[model samples]
Target: MRTLAGYTNIMSAKPGDTVEFKVSSHGPSATFSARLVRLITTEEHPRTAGLIERDVDAAFNGEYPARRQPIHTGSYGYVEHATAFSGLEDFTFQTWLWPTLLGSRRQTIAGTWDESRSLGFALEIDEAGRLTFLMGDGQGTVSTANLPTPLVERQWVFVAASYSAKDRTVVLHQSPRCDIGDLGSAETRKFDIAAVQGKSGQRHFFIAAHKASASDGLLLAGGHYNGKIDSPKLHAGALSIEEMASLASGAAVERLNECVSAAWDFSIDQGSDVFKDVSGNGLDGRLVNMPARAMKGYNWTGQFHDWRTAPHEYGAIHFHDDDLYDAGWSTDFAFTIPSGLESGVYAARLDAQDASPAYVIFFVRPPKGQATSDVVYLASTATYMAYANQTLIARDPLDEMSMGSLLVFGEDDVFLDENPEYGKSLYDLHTDGSGVCYSSRLRPILNMSPNAKYWSFGDGYLTGWLDALGIKADVITDEDLHNEGESILAPYRVVLTGCHPEYVSLAMWDALKTHLGRGGRLMYLGGNGFYWRTAFHPTLPGLIEVRRAEDGSRAWSAEAGEYFMSTTGEYGGMWRRQDRTPNQLVGIGFCAQGFMTGSYYQWSSGSSDPRVDFVFKGVNKGSKFGDYGLSGNGAAGQELDRYDPGLGSPRHAVVIATSIGHTDNMVLAKEEFGAMHWMIGGTENKNVRSDIVFFETSGGGAVFSVGSISWPMSLPIDNYQNDVSHVTLNVLERFRDPKPFSLPQ
Candidate 1:
């Protein structure tokens, strides 16, 4: 496990901008050294410029004391100003819950309890996973009314807890939405307590969790439940069983106006964090850690699949015990980008006395209107955020099978396995088995470590290759393109993408399309480019949302009625489903994928096309090249894409090369077929291959695509003298020329 770790406040910044670094150490008072570096390649491959980074002088390059910062992981709703719920002598709390987990740990249902003082009432699942009504007097005494039957997992249950000061009596009700014929039944559990004060304090109320402590308007809570909660209500009086049943049976709040204290309708704000208490008491609360919203409520019908259409049916919010939106760490140090700092990938190198050196990576962009070079490298920051802190290889068994090899675990992977509070990737499932739709970079992401064998580090090979070819290019990220749009690309004549620009937002797409329309040349040196429809949080930096809707080669599928993103209210899925397939933009879309060894590409008939003569100028006319390199031993491996005119590939697009000799594990994407069949594996399906493509746009713009994620990895083979490097260099030099591309009639 790593002894030291850190993250940046922002991933991309301008030359004059300031960025903060948040660092943590396992041992308090530990000393560490820090410095700045411009990273070119982060991998230690023998065939490449291994672990290449240039030292950059900075003022903060000295020793400093380190401290450990804790991350509190959980999602819950909080009502900070809960004065209306204070000093209640006779009260009732009820809600509809769909429990996804039970029996392991105690789970809080709604409560005003403070664990530190033990001074309030709480409806919680006891240690034995049974519903219980617990109350504690500020002095010392505590009382509980426990139900005999433990709640069933993943089953909907309506529960109520009522207390009456008249007789010191407490009533707990657990009513399942459907008949619990054989599992267990506890329609009512009533008991009288002796010497129990049943006092309530000024402690705030919370849904799905209770407070452990509070400071600076921030809460530290525990006992987080994993499930869906909907239509939680509180009443002024200790309501009878029939009254609580009426509320649980979907009775209108107006009908019981006299007793209603707060009826929190979760359907009020689907996009925002705060929820509404519709009982007119003006009680509103905000959600912390960003739980899965727009969940199907208990009363959901099959009529509508969108929350915008039938919000009432999507009233539930699914809370996970492991949901982490932010680490909330204090910034340990900061650096202001110096004037005339070239645009590139940079990192703050940290070294502790007893640990390996750590690198917290960030991108430096050129100042506004200060384009340093004619070429720009568009970093896939959105995709990096989507894959941040991924734990699939360790947590999921299917991943090993998909890779066709036993999984390997490094120190970072082991650390992530032991520490899930760091956060999850879009490809991971929540503790409740629901797909994670939101990913934030406000925490340390182990997978994005500069030396880690993940997407971001793999893309570093291209940066190192550019340095070898003596190409000066400005660096910009997806966030910059999304926020600044086409103007960020207007200064650059040629734009080069990373190896897997998978997640794309609407603004990024529009900017790229606009760039192409204005005669901007794009070298799409990537596969699976412009695939998943993605969104950035409008108000929050370093956060993104993606939903795996209907069909895709996905780890988990979003629920039926939850295909829209809570970040932007846009439909979440592949761009193909939206009729904006990647082929329409780059002449190729994702078609096949494999994790085994890679294969080489063979020249196709279109290689002879006069339009692509410049692309093959210095390359031999042999059938096979790019058969060896770092990634899977070849250029065409990992996720592959193909040109299909039917899927919006331009009719004028030419296939320069096609990959061959893939293992059977390489299979066609799920969206390519109506149902599963034998003709889906690489051995059987002709479609399971990567196709190198080229095409021209209406303007002088043109696109050259290498439809394989591993294509760029082949650049450093034979010390950058390989065929893959030659072909890439050829295209870059031609695209750099001012001559406009002409349409061949």
Candidate 2:
């Protein structure tokens, strides 16, 4: 490869073109990974000019002054410099550097030390023009020791720690080499110096008077540095060749900088855009070669826009393109932002050129509590999707199978399968029948307005959810889902899952998980929503493990006969099931033997909790959240709703309101008895909301199960209702507006 900045030339090459790079070491010690190369440009950041700071920039040594110096602004700074650790190996020091707006002494972020567990250095300007690190007086040992060193001034550093458990040692090496042995003899002390932190409960982890905490990892301050760290680093243990090489070559340092490369083949759109590394650091890059990121190894959507908006007041529609998801953007191929930019919220345009409401942020402000965003984070991983598939596909005919409105389940089309009874509901968007019988039946209803416009692009994704929620998150395709959470999901209050949102990926889970852990609320309206785990290879951004089932169960396997459970992490392990339990992390429980064609009972207070007792809400005209248990809807509703209804052949499910006689299957193992199934993670299940009178548990999640297959349909749409109280309104009231936000005399 060329220098870090040269990857663009490689990316500009057409298919079958060559991409090359070099990662050689010239220092005494060296460490590097093939993954460290990145090509930076202004393409990802349509609003910014150049890089502010790069990763792996901070460096320290006894070279300048032992004391810390503030490196601030314009993309390069040094920070948190101190006498970190020193021992028989070498004394070590570390700091971070960043670029700023104009001229400023504050870094976008700074490092924090466990002063209690670290050796503090003295920062003093000697008579010469050099910065130095000095301890107490001590006529001490001979020779020298090793220390920390930056590749150069203003470079960012991931982390640095040093220790000198041994007393007699001294030596020094400079940048590119990062070593230090001795300065001169030591003298006596005015006071005793502190030691560096060690692992576990060893004497090494002891705290010093320097003021420190063991876990002070992130410090979002501001500033940049004009100097470099001198003679740093001392390890608690002996240095092996690999370890020495690691420090020398700055292996971790490269990661600290965010490596990118034009080295991989690019066929499809990997949702390329600008992103932030850990410390307000940004990576600005994209997959210029269009065909490389394809799903089926073909670049068909090389032109369409996924969530792009109109001009003018349509700011929500800017900067996004219709990302070419191979057939569908599986979680396997991810769109990545390069490394070495400044910290801040950078926009990521995966589907369009204009900055549509869809984007990603790296340097976002800390959310006060649960960060709420109107954007939806759909799952991409085959594994998670498979999990959801198993849960949604196995339902009783007459059983109520509703998608969690607030759960953010799979897409609107998943529930439209061509199962035995209603398999015709499923549509093939790529083909001529995506709207299938459902769309054909509703076409007249939709066209009733005379000017009802047909959806020019894909399915009814936009109007289906956004119009219902009344919120403004654009329905993103598989293209822009990866980097969206950093900027997109941080603003909305709720994310809704569809009838059978079974296809979920890993990063999508992480983003959503982090979003919820931060206190966001979720409404799992459908069973087996986001359930699988999948990843994108560092090089391959398009080719995913496309799946099909022999028995039509919708369950995916590696090759032929092999199931997802049988696949390993790298070897294609699809979905990892938590287990089966009655009490879910959310208030939803699942079983398979009920919905096929049976009587779903009148939703009564199955337990003692008054909040969950459907009757407590008072039986109105039998809405979705009603106690009277309405069975169906209009002919249009029935024709539209009577499709596969998804949830086919679920091996394991948390059956909420199903017949007791059906045998439930989760992990594909044959079972002779009725097993209580469950899932893990999140504390939303059985949550006690402020509006709800008491703590309640449905199955798992901040959830409420209608215990029927068609509750979503029965739930009133807009102001139209099947009864007096709107179905979702009744449910929403119990959770939030119990007393009603509007009260009049």
Candidate 3:
């Protein structure tokens, strides 16, 4: 912090090394300005430059003192002499620290007071997110063009640049954003400066943003809060440009919530001293609302007791059609709770299927006197609309063996492939599915099981599996539920389901819609459930229906490939898959199938970040060293189906490869991590296919759906007999029960 008394010292910086710096705070009283330099020499006076400069603006709270000139700095620039010095070409680039995913990410300087803005200032970042140094001849000054990346978001980015013919690239690192949770922008590039080449002279450095320079390299772009720059860093030698960019990728893939979990034991037995245990979900499972399984004398009146009442809000993440939903993405987890509930300790269990050896459990205890908000509800299928439309079904006969069961909707009607944007194919275009797609070299998470119904989203035999875990979940028919869209997923810690729980009634979807908005949690056990845009019977109030594409096809017709260049190698935009901007809401890219049993899995060796990966309990650097390695499946480390084809940067999403397979298949993977997370992929059972994904939102609730259903029976019941089932259960268990401080014990 030496005041520049006219002379200058190079400080602790070398030609090829990085150093922190800033302009000395003494400009108004002194006639000279302080500046940083690339180098200082004797003959001809070598001058240091390569740094950005500007007058502090009113933005970022920078302002000129009364009766005094304002200090200027807080930008990046390169050292360039243009036509003023020797013909030698030499230039340096310096950057400012910018956060990517948190806080006021953009840099600001003083400006004319902005009445519209409370702070009276504006915010900004380099256009492309990166600056460049172009040094040639008389036309030599450095020209910085901002480069853009999908994951850099809006934030501050500091960079240091130096040029060398051997390797023309500047070295830089993306710093941590507002929170350690967000990884910063991680891209870096190299630039060759032809302006300051081998010029032999004593180079002098100037700063304090003196007068504008005609020969020194600088950008004319305006600033928000132009003020004297604060702590700065300078680097000698060229930094690895590519490495820097890789870092930004990490921030892009980070997830906000670890997971969520919830469970309840109804135990609703009456006429006994233990009547407080309303919906008797007995500790061991003997007393659920099992019409036939429970003792005849037990009363079923309290089955819904103690559970968060009707019309609950199930928090969920927003899912724009364009988001990445396949393998390996992350986002926020949220859901809504109903307005009326007897205050009690509640836990949201997040069971992330396929994530073995680790799980997440988050808990929430409502205020001591909190009451239920309102009755928000939704339908699960179009047939449910018939019931909501006032059509009623005869009560099931509790006395005789039930010949016909009530359709969960309580009415008679059916939804036959009714959503206009629904795209129905045996295979997913994003991955190599089995039929009706291009580059059919291999299947991508395809449901190849021969016995499955054509595009059917269900598989039988989920009871044994559900009971195996001792989870006292209700098996209410889809139509049995009601919703106002505001009653997301009321009265439940998390909405649990079997594999292939597709065929969502419009109300069911709307209920989920409310859950996410209100901050509920969700966990999809299987694939391909709730992938359509069905209609909730507004008139019926609680009925549900799907809107068909009107085409002879199975209602679904829009394809991600048709609307995006993603099918090839560039994922310019995939959100069109569901007509939503995924990054804005959900965090995944797409859904695929074929992650196999006994596949490999591993964690990134990049950095020891426990927050993003505490789920890897007991696993470490040396453990499972070869787990996520490249496999015979080229897709393990690279692209599988090729939609949005090219490798998405770490920022937008990351392939936390767990296992590789033949035909470029990575049996396991993890993707986007941020305010919201989308995990959508598929599987097949009995030759039928299904898919389900989780969309978590900013609040802390989520929605779980899948395209496949047969898997429930495959994994739930067979887990004891096979490793795949065990793995799936383990993963889902964790997702269903996430932890806030650490992985559940």
Candidate 4:
């Protein structure tokens, strides 16, 4: 509630790189303070239950005065043309609406009015789910009319409201396009007021929101609509029920009438922000806040599966009350990373007088040509960006089942709900109630900060484990690997990935594959790695797009004829659907997930192979490899991946260990089933186990997959001397050697 907030431009920066910070304050002038800190561990797990922070000397630790900044939220289109409704005795307004949040207090579908000034006209949904029309007479009196029946959310409906000033009467109609009879209704009423005329002159006309007067003399949004609206038409005269039906039935476009004042067609400029007025009234409007375009519209019949194939079917734009495409704030300060600083995780902690503190995290990498270490940790930045400031607590009801804790709410989770202006993740839904297909990292991602538990484990565990072992390793991000490709990993002997690297872009996938192909070593220390096939916009720096097309553990499925990304026009879905399953690259593919408890890994048949002797240097062959750990209280739980030859696992791949004793809470992923039955849980099915796999490429390269998200949490146990730690260190030490892997003849 304090009012100061900010975000950094980039997630990570190399030494000698300049980073910018953008801050905003809602109150009067306030001073801000910032410092550098390295987050060690804040895991609430019983095994690791303490907050730790390491300070780093920074030049900018003093306070500086700053002013208030604007925050833009919601998406809609607006027209600046001024017109007086007072002159017309009879006028009609109609539009196709697809409401996402019908239960919200109030929402505007389309209106040429200002609510604060109490003038003009508007057709909106009231708090009680009724369609209400309001007209102001400029003299101070406002006439109101309402429809009897409430509309359903996420359904396409044609809504029309008409006002006859001569008769002082108003009529409202609601007609569902589909055969859902209960969703359609109509009502008519007469007001006692005289002929009401709108306040003449330049008044605002908007689709998703009405204008409200603010203290700064700026027009702020009021009753912002969350949903899709199409083909808003304004007529100079009231039309009959038959005429309204014809307009809603697609006949209005073909047979133009003299009563039509303006009809805006949203299908013309599918990729651009400009909306054209097909009625020839020159009332073209521009889209604000970047509402999702090229979506399946009202006339869509599901004949095609891709929007590019049939552009007409994808004319709708999804608007969300929490949709924030950009912050557009000015930079408050900037800092250049010193050339001598080590490559690791760093944060800029901001403090203000009597206000809550803030932290902007970024990773520091080695110089361009510098290879200071034999090992490299690949930050799962793409996955981090995908789940940035997610609002799953508001939507998903199975929080305890998903988060593995009955009291799983964190401070960061509460912050996201209080300030929705930070925007939503791809796991969220838009204002129109459709799944969010795109996510951008250009804003502050509260959960991505140090010590913040995302999916039951934080990235700090991996970094802290490496620091405890006194290992010198470089750090690189998913974006760096994406842009630079294989060349970025060519210098490092071994690469380590963080927990839950589930989201992978096309370029990043090829880079890792190429690195493995040419004698490079990879350690996939997480489950559900390289699962979703994602795309990054070429021009848009920090935005990523995903389409949850065919099977997987998905929150929401993409609608038919919309499985392709609008940003890059490429097919989106699981990599397995494209015949490039993760088992082919890292020796394991996502199989099952459970959050109740974690189990331990047992030795597999391949563990007896003499060629893999170096993997168990300090571990007992008879004992369970990972019987104790931090995550879920064991090394294998949450989500587990398995090696299956039928799915694309290489013939030479060896499964050194497999987890056992998973509870009934763990179930097989949807993609693993062709038909649904009861034999999908870990207790019923043998496939719901993580396979610690090891395989060598033809060019002396190798791959090792831990196959569980909790595996790394087991590394910091016994002072880093446990069996899990031993096996991982053995692989890292041997993989870093200059000698090549000795393949059997």
Comparison by TM-score, 1 against 4, better one: 1
**All candidates in order of lDDT, best leading:** 1, 4, 3, 2
lDDT winner:
1
**Against the hidden true structure, what lDDT does model 2 obtain?**
0.24
Give the Å error, residue 478, model 4: 2.4
Regions of candidate 3 where Cα sits further than 4 Å from its true position: 1-463, 476-488, 501-510, 539-578, 581-586, 589-609, 612-659, 662-697, 702-745
lDDT of 1 by residue, 509-608 (tens): 9999999999999999978889999998888777889989988888899888789887777999999999999999999999998888888999999999
Compute the lDDT for candidate 1: 0.86
Please write out the lDDT profile of model 3 over residues 644-735, one tens digit for every residue: 21222113222222322222222222222124333323221111111122333545554433222223333322233433244344434454
In order, candidate lDDTs are: 0.86, 0.24, 0.26, 0.78
**TM-score of candidate 1 versus the correct structure, residues matched by position:** 0.96
Total backbone clashes of candidate 1, pairs 3 or more residues apart or in separate chains: 0
In model 4, what lDDT does residue 709 have?
A: 91
Q: What lDDT tens digits, residue by residue, belong to model 2 across residues 1-745? A: 1110001111111123322321112122222222211112111112222222122221110111111111111111122212222211333433221111212221112122223432223221122212223332122311111232212222222233222435422222122222264232211111113332232222121100112233334221112222222112222232223333355445553432332211112111222311111222121222211111112111122232221211111111001011111211112112233232221222221111121111111121222222333334232222221221122322322113322122222222132231111111111111211111011110001111111111111012212223344533322323234434434455544444433343444555555556545444344443333333334333334222222322222322222221221111222232324231212222332322112221222222323343344424444422222222222221011101110112221222222222111112112111111354442111121210001111222222233333223333333333233331243445444433223111111
Q: Tell me the deviation in Å of residue 453 in model 4.
A: 3.0
| lDDT minimum window of 10 residues, candidate 3 | 287-296
lDDT-best of 3 and 4? 4
> Which candidate order results from sorting by TM-score in descending order?
1, 4, 2, 3
Better of 2 and 4 by TM-score: 4
